[model samples]
Target: MTSITIRNVPDEVHRALRIRAAMHGRSTEAEIRGILEQAAKPEGRLKLGTLLNSIARDAGGLSDAEARRFDKLRDRAPAEPMRFE
Candidate 1:
């Protein structure tokens, strides 16, 4: 394993990291390691259905009627093409 030294991190950011580490019951160094690990890994792509489901869940789950109305709005015809002289 390699070691690194991060130089000149802002005081507020360092403080926040310490607070987060305390919250998660980890040392600040361990918290930094976890942060670096997550940053190094590529995040998985969220599919449209998955993204929509998450949004619906956060918004208290959309009603069936609301979903239908959204679908109708989404399927509406595009606006008329611009006619430039």
Candidate 2:
């Protein structure tokens, strides 16, 4: 877990934060956490999985039947555990 300390916040800003926190039914700290979380890692950000899917779509997208056939062709059995004496 990581901890951050914000310094010298203006009084009016702090009061507004408190009010917003109350409106959201959360503690001021929780409100700040949610705000910071959203600011830092936004919902609309391009995720790796999403980017890969987009790329796949651009490059003649993988079809369900192709995916099913791929799965059928794979080695499904669990791998043998390594013996390191």
Best candidate according to TM-score: 2
TM-score between model 2 and native: 0.70
lDDT of 2 by residue, 1-85 (tens): 6999999999999999999999999999999999999999999899665577567756877775765565578676767989999
Estimated TM-score per prediction?
Answer: 0.50, 0.70
The list of candidate 2 runs beyond 4 A from truth reads 64-85
Candidate 1 per-residue lDDT over residues 9-61, each given as its tens digit: 99999999999999999999999999988887647856565579568957888
Which residue pairs does candidate 1 place in steric collision? none
The models' CA-based lDDT, in order, is 0.83, 0.84
lDDT of 2: 0.84
Clashes of each: 0, 0
